[model samples]
Target: MPNKKLTDVEKLAIVQEIEGGHIGINAAVRKFGFSKSTLMKWRNRYRLYGMEGLAIRTCNRSYSAELKLQAVMDYFRGELSQYQIIDKYKISSRTQLADWIKKYNGHSSLRAYNGGKTAMTKGRSTTWQERLDIVLHCLANGQDYSQAADQFKVSYQQVYGWVKKYEAGGPEALRDGRGRKKAPEELTEADQQKLAMRKLEYEVERLRAENVFLKKLQEFQRGRR
Candidate 1:
């Protein structure tokens, strides 16, 4: 059975039961069908703030930008791990810490990652222009998707997906609403030919660069003789 969301009252009662030694935490979790982590979270909250800490939050709490940056800096500075940050900040999960780090590192955005109404959106949305800009920047800088994501305020997955689409369909492929089952509008014959030509041009350019590198390597080898 799926784990049910426990109310604050229910959580407090369970914690109290365990604290009273009526049942061990492990046994209570087995009997109640709750995970050990869940019980541990409840116990921790209870210990820190009593019943008030277990209160069910109706809305997601928003952290200030400064707080988010501070947490990320702390992690980056090796001052603490995600778990330690959670305890220090009274945060509910390590995932929140990670999201803060991603946003601070320019791999995500405050608007996208903030625990707002639309926070549940799977990934950040990007326009075709932004996609093209990211792709071009990555190519120009010789950056992989991860590096591009960190430099461009986008997810690595997004960068990778956009590059694949651009390769398969050229600039036109970077348009929105990809991966959906609905067929996109038909491209003109000229547009189809243009995409093919663009792809070929990119491949030729890559090959030329590789050829130059190989020639340089051969010269160095010959000079070592």
Candidate 2:
């Protein structure tokens, strides 16, 4: 929401060009280097509230739990799409609304917004088990990395890195590798069996998490269509 790149006048000019057919949306996106979604949001906001809507807020805005709940409920009523609900409630971005919907669906409590005060900006040391649990929580909650980071008191980068690493190389990849790796001959039969079982369990968990994310994405897309 804090877009220092474009001012209100500049935003209005671009929106007018797109609206007046002087430039197509795709061409505007290519020329202005803005995402299609961002451009479309500007156009919609301009239509709904004129130049006032396009003006960026100077300060951080906070929403109450009741307001968030109302907006989410309106969304579930199926009367308006995400953008419409966003425009109706003047929420900052679609991503924010999607996060709220994920929380609602996951049965997580929606507390009053405090302008992201609870988020950690710096990374912290974590063990392999803690990293794995954080990644699992993030994936299970539809990849809500911010929520996971806040809940675990770790930086967002750490949570994101762990999730990506796990997806690419499985659980063992999360290890810091500060210690020497055990040679194949150093492992006993029971040790090998335990390692294999843990790998299998992790794979199942990864697949289940992916399935949950895919289902949520599909549902959202279907609703939009």
Candidate 3:
């Protein structure tokens, strides 16, 4: 934290040596807070555009949305694997890909939920930005989608779908849905009538949760009992 900075020359020297197999990526990582992903990122750029690619990243060239979207599309159409896209783009990690795919999907729709002036744009619609935030939070906090969904007040399916969209198109996947409402489940009137008497579903869920809490409480109480 001593205002350390790696210059272009230093990064190039370190990255070149790693790519050339002169020094281990792990060693560099431990010595300089580098990781395989960082090595991969530098290697990808160096391989594609050489030293020029690894030059100090600037907003002008580093966060190229167009380039990221293209990579997502390429990955989606089976034209390139995520690794290949990252490798070719000199991208260091999967976050950019996830973000791009989410964004790409959002823009493909004609509806407003696609993040523009359209019929589908209304309500507190979920967004790729939100989705990515949720996904990353879940990952960083070490929870799976189902658990994360419960905490986020979204469906597990929605979370999974977003994850899929991200994989397919990057962040664009999350943005594709503007503020569109979720279609109702395909239950007919008859089915609704038949199921109306079944308090078991809700009851079961409530009871299960209560049971878990009670079990934990009992454990704690036992210590004091």
Strongest candidate by lDDT: 2
Q: Give the per-residue lDDT digits (tens) of candidate 2, residues 1-225.
A: 334589989999999999999999999988888889999888977876788878887764577655676677678768999988988888877887898778777756666767434334457899877887787667766787777877898765578778988887666667897775455556688856866666567568778877888999999999999
Stretch of 10 with least lDDT, candidate 3: 113-122
Q: What 10-residue stretch in candidate 1 is worst by lDDT?
A: 113-122
**Model 3 per-residue lDDT tens digits across residues 1-225:** 224666778878888788778878788777677667766677676777787777786553444433454465567668778878887776655676676566546653222222332211012357555786665545444435645565665644466566666566554346665674333254466645544433345356556766888999999999997
Clashes of 3: 30
Model 2 bad stretches (over 4 Å): 1-4, 114-225
Model 2's alpha-carbon lDDT is 0.76
Q: Quote the lDDT for 2 in model 2.
A: 36
117-194 in candidate 1: lDDT tens per residue?
211112377877678777765664454655666666665556766877777776767886657432334767786675
The TM-score obtained by model 1 is 0.42
TM-score of each: 0.42, 0.43, 0.40
Q: Which has the greatest TM-score? A: 2
